[model samples]
Target: MPETLLVLLAGLAAGALNAVGGGGTFVALPALVAAGQSPVTANASSTIALVPGAVAGAWVYRRELAPVGPASTKSLTAVSVLGGGLGAALVLALPSESFDAAVPWLLAFATVLFAFGGRLSGALRGTLDRPLAPGPRTVLVMQFVLAVYGGYFGGGVGIMMLAVWSVGLGIDSATGNPMRIAQLAAIYVSATALFLAISDARSSPLVLTTMVAGAVAGGFGGAHLARRLPARLLRAVVLSTAVTMTVLYFLRG
Candidate 1:
């Protein structure tokens, strides 16, 4: 089969998973690398390709987006945008070898978060839901840091954001979901912009076009399906998939 056909199929699968579960890069990145792209190139390509999917997913949850507090949204957006730019720059400037060693560790951490996500959410709810303490300034700081990580290598960013909001900010996962999507959209948008500014323009347009097509289709499907599925079940599916991918990354490493 032709390589382009293979990439397009992979993009479709990744987009579907991204819309529903997150960690689409676990599929897309390896596909790009196997297609003869360098790790750096593949990483950048995957990041760029995934932007439309993120945007599409965010749009599918547009109604929920309005309920997020404006002040928090603004703060998170600013930090995420700045951090994403910095992270994209670092990715472009640094040697790929530096990141190769770290990928497995990062994947493992993401896996642990996914595997224990429900219990962690429950614990946070028990401790933090009473009287609603003031949000932490430190959480805002951490948001920027996590945004940087997302920009540099965005496999399980959604899960990480959920953890930060639930554990650090004392926000419930259900309440924080829309805000997480918005903040991630900001991060990806900023990172995409930075990559366009710094990197060579070879092969990006083709990848972006096909990816966007798949993402829009999958986003609609995922969002529609989400409305039908029980929240607990949906969350479980995402958690399981994320954990499985993280374990695979560790083994591959």
Candidate 2:
């Protein structure tokens, strides 16, 4: 089979997986590497290509954004955008081996969070409505750190954001999804911009274009399903996929 056709197929599969489960990188990354791109280049290309999908997914959930208090949204957005730039810079500066070695550990940590995240998030939801008024400083700090991680590596960030927003910031999952989507979109935009300005992204244009197209389609579908689907099943699927992909990443390493 032709490489272009193969990439487009992989992109389609990745889009569907990402929409449903948020592990699209697990598909696109390997496909890029197999097609002879270096791991670092593949990672950068994948991040760039995935941005449009994330945006589409976020737009699907845009209605959820309406109810969030403006102050909270503004605060999180600021931190996410700033942190994304820092993370992208770190990715550009890191040695390829170091980045590769870190991927497994990051994946493992995200998997663990997804596993226990439900109970934790449930406990915090009650507090979200009470107007406790915790300062934004801590949330900003955490967002910066997470955005850096997201921009640099780009897997499981959604789960991490869900946990943080639900548990740390005292937001319910339903409201948090839109906020998370916005934050992630900011991070992706910042990171992609930095990568294009300073890194070598020209090497994988074909792969990038096809993957983005697939992700955009899948994201729209996923968001639509997310609105209608039961939360329990969505959480279960997301957690299971994250764990399985983490294992795969470790084994591949």
Query: In model 2, how large is the Cα lDDT of residue 49?
Result: 75
Q: Residue-wise lDDT of candidate 2 within 1-253, one digit each (tens)?
A: 4777766666766655665656777777787787778877777777777778778877877767842333467777777788888888887887667777777888787677657665665555556655433466766777788898888877777767766655554554455665666677788888989888877777667767877777677767777776676766777777787888889878988
Residue 109 lDDT in model 1?
75
Q: Tens digit of lDDT per residue, candidate 1, span 1-253?
A: 3666666766776666666656677888887776667777777777777777667767877777632322466677889889888888888877767676687777667657655655676675678675333354566787888888888887777667765554444454445555666676788788888877777525556665665566556655665565565667766766787677777877887
TM-scores of the models, in the order given: 0.85, 0.85
Residue clash pairs of candidate 1: none
The lDDT values for all models are 0.69, 0.72
- Tell me the TM-score of model 2: 0.85
Deviating ranges (above 4 Å) for candidate 2: 66-71, 118-134, 170-175
Whole-structure CA lDDT of model 1: 0.69
